[model samples]
Target chain A: MRWIRETGPVVGAITLALGVGAIVTALTGYSVPQVFRHLAVGAFGDWYRLAQTLTQATPIIFTSLSFLIAFRAGLFNIGAEGQLYMGAFFAAWAGFSFQLPPVLHPIVCLLFGAAAGAVWGFIPGWLRAKRGANEFVTTMMLSYVAINFTSWLVAPGGPFHGTAWANQTVRIATSAQFPRLLRGAQLSWGLIVGVLVAFLVWYLLFRTPRGYELRAVGQNPLAAEYGGINVTRNMILALTLAGALAGMGGAAETLGTHRRFIELFSPGYGWDGIAGGLIARAHPLGAILAAVMMGALRAGGQAVDRAGVAPADLAAVIQGLVILFVVAPELIRYFRRLVRRKKLGDIEL
Target chain B: MEILSFNLFISALRLATPIALVALGETYSERAGVINVGVEGMALAGALTTAVVAYFTGWPWLALIAAIGVGALLGALHAVWSVYLRADHVVSGAAINLLVLGFALFLTRVIWGWRGTSPSAPTMNAWILVGVGLFLIGLSQVYIFRTPWGLRLRVVGEHPRAADTAGINVYRTRLAYTVLNGALCGLAGAFLFNNLGRFTDGMVGGRGFIGIAAMVVGNYRPLPALAAAYLFGFVDALQMRLQDYIPSQFSLMLPYFLTVIVLAGFLGKAQVPKALGKPYVKEQG
Candidate 1:
């Protein structure tokens, strides 16, 4: 019952988006039911499909929670893409360059990833906290810096170049790789760790004094300040924490899946995470389910193209619409109310 | 003597054209108490519209008018949702950004049957557009500071209640300016492709976002924002020239790095309009 109530709006949003998608599919001269059937089968047809879906979900779960934390503090950290790149790059660099005990190697690499992301995150947080800079613009500008700088770093003949022709770093040491969870499958402990982080974030936000201060700052900063909470400090702390989570996600993706940092490592996973946060309404634990839903869409995106059902970019369109509906639920409600009024009077519909 | 070269000056103006128009548009909307991050999307859509019109008809002026129409339509969509429903300003902007991006990319395949770029179209003389943009900025400065309509718009941003009490329709004023802002952004988009002579994927290249930063760095005023746009444009041109002396990446990062430094140093002193980003409830107003 609780789950139903919590996901009520998300379900409505998905339904609306699918309705729009169906219309689009029809316009392309395809059967909507067949397209959806293929989508479901492609995302969850077998054990292999399930693993692919979960793999697609893990990183977004991490970044969505990152957005969730910053959002709860009334700060928008849209720079998750930049932080993810920093995290992935540094983690891969540490994984390849370091000589450590097998067990310690992965841990050190992951830590470096989080630290790099934190530094990236902290810049905008500090600017917003100490100065009055809007993180929206500052973080965005820095994202280009991150993208171009990373591109240059990995370009052939550039620093951090590996032995390959591709613009990427050397492969990580075997000891640094995440242990696979299943035989013949790429699934690893990374998915479990992602879910665990969600729970931990929930505990931190709801059951701790510092979390209370963060929420207070988010809810009413002037009131929080008047009540003796250090609003400025909490704002910076929340954003930094958010960045750390995104960094961890990037590390998990690099260490668990690719085992190296490559150019265009993310297929806009950061933006997908932003959509996840909105779908979850900034709830930490809820981000897990939202991430999986997004993952299925991503998997379905490929399926539709392969099956000749629709364009591969249909997922992007649907995700965008889902964000629209979720961010402004009132838009749906207002339309619904108008429909009801019309039905009660002249029955316009 | 070389620093004052006519070629360098022209290149700087060329680089600054899109950023200048976007910054001016952002300044207007922000002053009207609406934050429209959709400038990025609007600009992209406008560019595509320009490319399509220019490619098929070879009429650059028609493309300009069409781009403004597209921008206004998008701006109206934002205004209606934000003004009436009081949607979360930033979130709504992000939604528009996402939807417009996907929609524009999807249209490329449908219209041109090409992959990521449009066919190179003929470009017209763009010096007239740059002159028009500079003239508009100057005119807007005077109109905003010295005109009665401009005072009403500022009052709506700074104090909606005062504007309401003074018989000004705050909602209508905000909606009007927001639509106008979109038109300006559309103009900026048209300039981008017209100057470049073609449309490429991701051609806006985050200039829409950079323009927003410039508006803030300039204290959200048109004159200062125009100067900020030129400064950013100068860095872009300087970076290209510095490629011979330094690693190109370092040069590439100059504008962004400088923007951050400039923002950090200036933001604390910059005061946004008081009612900015807040939805004005009719009762409260």
Candidate 2:
């Protein structure tokens, strides 16, 4: 019941905002009704679109879960982007460099990718926990280093370079590809893995002793310290787990979707995870749902591009609005209340 | 050899000016206890606005003012979200980045009808702009450390509760300094546009992040921040000059790589403002 009340206003506001956006578009010379109709059809008009949205949602789920975990432990983990890239790079390396049985290959590649992301995440987490450095700056800086390093690896004369100047790596072996869960659709076993991970995260955070300690530290590190929990170790562990999840997201995207490591493959999924985690209020299930909505918006917006209407930059606009509205609901509520009170005053007169 | 060194020094100075200006701008906001992580977004907005305004108006100075105004608008939005609404500063900052990026992309497509926008340069060259930047840097150091307002801002950062007890309005001070910071950051962006003669999407690149690094490396002192900026500038200039010797990719990444190493090594001991990133809520005694 409490959850219903909390989410109710968000849903209402989003619907109203969408309507307003449509009206604005109509007034400004685009057919808003047609655009929305097309978007609905394009996104869920068929099974293919549904599968594509689901497939896109899969990586977002992992990354958003990663963000939720770190945030729960009071760590920012801005390096998730870098960690994801590292995971992709490692997954690609494992997939392309090795010859293994089809049944075992994808699993091996994913684990390697997870390990790489964990290592990437661990650098800043350990630094913050042990040395008391600011995680925000360290993690953000690491992102650049990771991006550059990945670019360097795929450049000519680098270890993972493709045989051309096109700035991409060789395609992975067929064995390393994630098996399709649905025929004729891009949906893969990765979606199941992502859902399972979300449940595991929910269970770990809500039903475990370590989860209690992590939350305690997040709420008040000093209190947790006084309660005898190893705060630094927990911080490091939280970041490691978070990075592993994000790394798996990168791995899933590569092995399940692209099958090759390309420079700048991500359209800022890690940053999107930040927004997703915040929107979901760091709940595992909520993060999954928000990730899907975001994925849908991205896919639907791309579909709308085909229908003209300038594509609308709706994803970014909605993302910004959601954060603004969620964080400052009082602004909307106060205004509404003021209007109501003024109307009442006028009626009394 | 002397001329070579002189040219190197000039190049380093040119690179350092924008970073130093942005860092100094950030100093005011941070001193007033607000971490202006939107510096990147603000600078980007300022750069794009300045480029467009300068291109049409044929007046570089007016363009600078427009950039400052745009930056202040962005700062106001951040202040409302982070300070007034008491949202997470980092989250608000990230949203601002996304908003600016989206807006810039949309405006570019609508106005320029191209995927990218590049404006022609005015009369003032990079060297003249570098001179102006140096002058601004000197002025900022004096104004930030020496003024009464500066002292109050610093107090707000160091001990907001005490400052409040001393009858200072922490919120107002933060608002004022954030606007000031935005203007200075705008100036930095304007320099990039009017001086460099063209605008690229990645023009600001990671310089805004580098400015944050410089702030930390300098221990939040203005002169030291300038020195740190110059140090980074030297590395950047050196990378450009040595691109033939070193792989350009490695060169391009040099500053960021060094930042990670330096931050990992030294930032453990760096003491930030006590009230940084914490919204000030006046406590009733």
Most TM-score-accurate candidate: 1
Model 2, runs deviating above 4 Å: A8-35, A163-165, A181-185, A312-314, A329-349, B1-4, B116-124
Q: Write the per-residue lDDT of candidate 2 for residues A1-349, one digit (tens) a residue.
A: 9998677656655665476556545654667777677666666778888887788788889888988899899888767788889899899999999999997999999999899999988988998898776676777777777888898899887777885967779999999999887788878888888889899999999999999988888989999999999999999999898889999999988898888898888877887787677777788988888888777766776687677755545445555556555555555565567788898875532
C-alpha lDDT score of every prediction, in listed order: 0.83, 0.79
- CA deviation > 4 Å runs, candidate 1: A1-6, A25-34, A182-185, A339-349, B1-5, B113-115
Best by DockQ: 1
Listed per prediction, chain B TM-scores read 0.95, 0.93
TM-score to native of every candidate shown: 0.95, 0.92
- Candidate 1 lDDT, B73-189, residue by residue in tens: 888878877877788778777778877777665556556656447887867677778998899899989988899988988899999989998999989988998898889888888
lDDT of 2 by residue, B119-157 (tens): 464534657667776777787778778998778888999
Model 1 pairs in collision: none
DockQ of 2: 0.50
DockQ of each: 0.65, 0.50
Residue by residue across A72-191, what tens digits does model 1's lDDT show?
A: 999987878878888888889889888888878888888888898888889899999998778877777777788778878888768887867798888999988888777777777779
